[model samples]
Target: MTDHHPDPAAPQPGAAAPQSACPADWDPLASQRRPEDPPLDVLLSGTVFFDIVFTGLDRLPEPGEELWSKGLGSSPGGIANLAVAAARLGLRTGLVAGFGDDAYADWMWHTMSEEEGIDLSASKRFPDFHSALTCSIAAQGDRAMVTHGHDSPEPMSRLVQHAPAARAAVVDLAGETDWWGRFTSGDTKVFADIGFDETGRWDPADLAPLAHCHAFTPNAVEAMNYTRTESPDRAVRAIAELVPLAVVTDGVDGSYAIDQTTGEEAFCPAVPVTAIDTTGAGDVFAAALVLGTLAEWPLEQRLKFGSLCSALAVQQFGGSLAAPGWGDIVDWWGSLSTAAQAGDLRAGYTRGPYMFLDDIVPDHPVQGRRRAQGTFAMRSDAGHH
Candidate 1:
């Protein structure tokens, strides 16, 4: 069997790698196709909780100034949102993380174990730690967040010790890095999503353990931070050196991917849509990409599915609330594709108008517009600063 390898050196943009029309003798697909449903076992192994979002009508008040909320509510957040999105897409999902001994934790567990199809057997209950939460101020559908909580790191040995059947593990790097080394040594496919906190940012060094990951999905800012590069193309190139596949999402600017196996890069243009709330757009994209890959869809199709899912997420406030199920996404994709063909480029779909406590703020600026469109662009415009 011949080993598949990618060029270690960077290829000039637009330069094509040599192509092979036929599969090698040792290609995994050399055997006959199996007639079984694609395995749905996926572990969303990381932070879990509800986000307590508070949105205001205008810019946040000065330190001593009091302000009223336009809206407020609690919803699933962090890896919990990712897991729910995966479950909604028909994956047999599980979560491996810690939750507090608070009412929010109860809500989180019930939602995962009862309302959703996720297995919560591995979740550790901590009595002292606060359940993760995020508070946001909304202006014209865009939001600024203030979040708190510490994600307890689960040991890789403990995770592997449970030994449930799974095809892949989605790691949200909000926990300890040591477990990463152990997690990646197994044969299961590995994918990672980055998270940030108030006093710290996700360090690229933490990703070194996942040197041969099946895929790395990072929004443009995270990608730039990982690569230490100013240019998006350069960041993509740098990340390809560490992982087999790297996807860099730049909001409305679209997304790009580098195939480590072939040293080929593909671009997925963002589906043009008006967005209401921009939360959870990246998580939705990650879940959709995983589903598409599991379905063996082509690379471009996988990105298209992911991008469409993200578009739907921004149409509403909060992360998980805005996520569309697989069926809804398929329908939306069909409509978008048809619209694209007809040159009605601006027609798109969104998922939410869900009410929140913060929506009560008097004179709030986001009353009628979607936030995802311009907010992410503005937030990421600095490109990793």
Candidate 2:
């Protein structure tokens, strides 16, 4: 068993230089095109199972090399991690993924069933396949992971068919070719989160089925790979041409989005926090983005919420342990604002309407203020009234 340990240098709330920004405009209904909520009921499909994560360790062994982990335990892996993050944030969630007949799978089932707002009727037991496992090695709060999938395509398809009513369906593109069409054709809003292989690569054609998906969450590296562009802005624009909503996250540099309607680019700054293990940080960000969309918090707020969730996610060792609840996120945001206000850093800082954190973090403090006001002006003119 590998032991997982959190990085000692990971930033605690008061430890690092606090990131401060003006609170985004609290517009509760800024992006509600429809009268009804998008879909609070979330169906999480794709890979699911216990992840045997190891932290405070090094690379996977070669032919023969001893490695020690500071901790070891099981938590939801892949798409399930997003589900857990959403559920913790008080969304009604369900799972449509395959599990194995192993003891680890049993634990996964039991834990997910007991989660406050998650429904697991769609989870299946695959006898031939063991539960998925991910072993992570943490160095300076960054992680390297090795994962194994024990299930085949056939069983995964069956599990997906059993999903209950869901407002949106989040699919981890773990090589699920057939599932995309089915979900998109259904009443569910589709969100695809693509995973990266050891080569740090994936094919853009893999996302073709999800062309009209409600949202696509890709990290900066994946965005570059998908669009074959060195510039994140160009990558986002390229992706938005394919999908209506393209969210590209760049670790500490921040994130950007391409608006499908007007072909505009929106950037948000990374919530400044000392990261510990950025293992499931992106997953957590994706989950929050989807949830915020469901709530119609406007594009800017949705991205900020995601940034806040991700910032909190990297403070711990494992993915699930680091995931923060809604209250914790609010506190973090509030703390950021408080810190910013207390320091002399507020020179020329204009607290415009609250936008996503990614928008403000990358620019000079004064520039961010100007950008925030400009965003509000554009939104006002763009029929967000």
Best by TM-score: 2
Q: Can you write out model 2's per-residue Cα lDDT over 1-385, one digit (the tens) per residue?
A: 0112211221222121111111121222233424454333577666764555666555555567778776654466666677767765555567667667776676556545532235666666667678777765665545666777755545556656655556777776656656546667666778877767566556667777666587777888878887899988888888887877888888899899976744556788987777756767887887787777667556777777788778877765556545665435455445556766777354214222343543323222110001001011111110111
Q: Estimate each model's TM-score.
A: 0.70, 0.72
User: Residue-wise lDDT of candidate 1 within 184-222, one digit each (tens)?
Assistant: 666667787665444555566777655757888877887
Candidate 2: where is the Cα deviation over 4 Å?
1-40, 57-73, 126-129, 141-149, 152-154, 197-204, 262-264, 334-385
lDDT of each: 0.59, 0.59
**In the order shown, what is each candidate's alpha-carbon RMSD?**
15.3, 13.1
Cand. 1 TM to true fold: 0.70
Global lDDT of model 1 = 0.59
